[model samples]
Target: MTFREGCWRRRLRGEWFPGTRLTLRALASELGTSVQPVRDAIGKLTVERVLVLRPNYSVQIPNIDRELMDEIFAIRNLLEAEAARRCVSVMTDADIDDLEEAILATRRVYWVESEIPSRVTTIQGVSRILAERCGSEALCEQLINLRARTAPYYAAALARSDDGEDAEFVTFTIRIQDEFVTALRRRDEVAAAEIRKVDLYTFQHYIYRLLDVE
Candidate 1:
């Protein structure tokens, strides 16, 4: 990656706070490059929605808003569950195997002895893979957008100390995955939808509690 691209990536990873200003001159100074590269980087990130252009004619990091978070999760629940249900009827043996392997791998990557690791882009990656194979492109696209927006929260939750919540959190994930895979294998659309609803609600509750305590 170019220096400016690397910087923008780091900023997306929350190395820089939301609403951080990024002017061409300032970024050029930090990147030790000319303004052209900075402009290129800014343009790329703008397309990705990783950076937002402010009304005052400067670039700023995307800011977190509670309402937006809710809407994202709500749409995520609807589209993902529906798509997963649809996918089961058309799933090949290889698809089931891949889904199971991806979930198991994500379980290991996300939780280390019931403790969250410092960086967790892998879990998101795997989730995207699972969501991608769904029957509907529109559903997958919506899920991708929702997951991208909510990723930082998941990372934040992982970075939190396990404290006494380790067992509960791990168990929750295991239960959700079990229900999901079971419903898929059986082609039980109703069960799959219910499981997803429960999973999403439980997840929101956990995040709220964790963030509140922190």
Candidate 2:
């Protein structure tokens, strides 16, 4: 994979926490490449607001304070819910079946200590299906950008949770996914939107609680 794609995957898997800093030299060495490609990759991600360039020639994952968290989730709730609603009318039975299978895969990996990356990927797979089928390319692009921005924080939040809380959160996520698929299967756009809202709210609640304790 290219450096940018590798960086994005790492962020989504919570391999790096919010506010984590890195130098170009370090990234180049880690990727076994020269600094120029890493610099180019950083420039692109910086434009996407996925990475922040510093005056010291370092890059950092943008930190999420409570206020920023609220802002991000608020926009996410609006856009993601709308995407879910829009996709309902467009989704085929085959698409819904695929989503159900993905959710089942999520359940299997959520409890495995070594499968956190797979768990994250499965959840993202469900979201990608909705966004792509939402029938609005602009909305889909916006949702993807928003997801990239918040992914590190999501990973950080789960990393901070206790095992019991972690399991509970994963279970809650799986239940929400199931409900969303059900709504899609029924072509109930309103219910699909509302369920999407609830999923974002629950995630925001978990992150907010973690922030409070910190």
lDDT of 2 by residue, 31-139 (tens): 9999999999999999988899987779999887777767777998899899988988888898888878866775665466654455556656666777887899999
Tens digit of lDDT per residue, candidate 1, span 95-199? 878877877876665455433322445455434665777766777766765665566566566566364675677678788978888987888878876776776
RMSD of each: 4.2, 2.5
Residue-level error in angstroms, candidate 1, position 179:
1.5
In candidate 1 the C-alpha lDDT for residue 212 amounts to 60
- Decoy 2 TM-score against native: 0.85
Cα TM-score per model: 0.72, 0.85
Best by TM-score: 2
Distance from true position, residue 163, model 1, in Å? 4.9
Model 1 weakest lDDT span, ten residues long: 113-122
Q: Which residue pairs clash within candidate 2?
A: none
Scored against the true structure, residue 211 in model 1 reaches a CA lDDT of 56
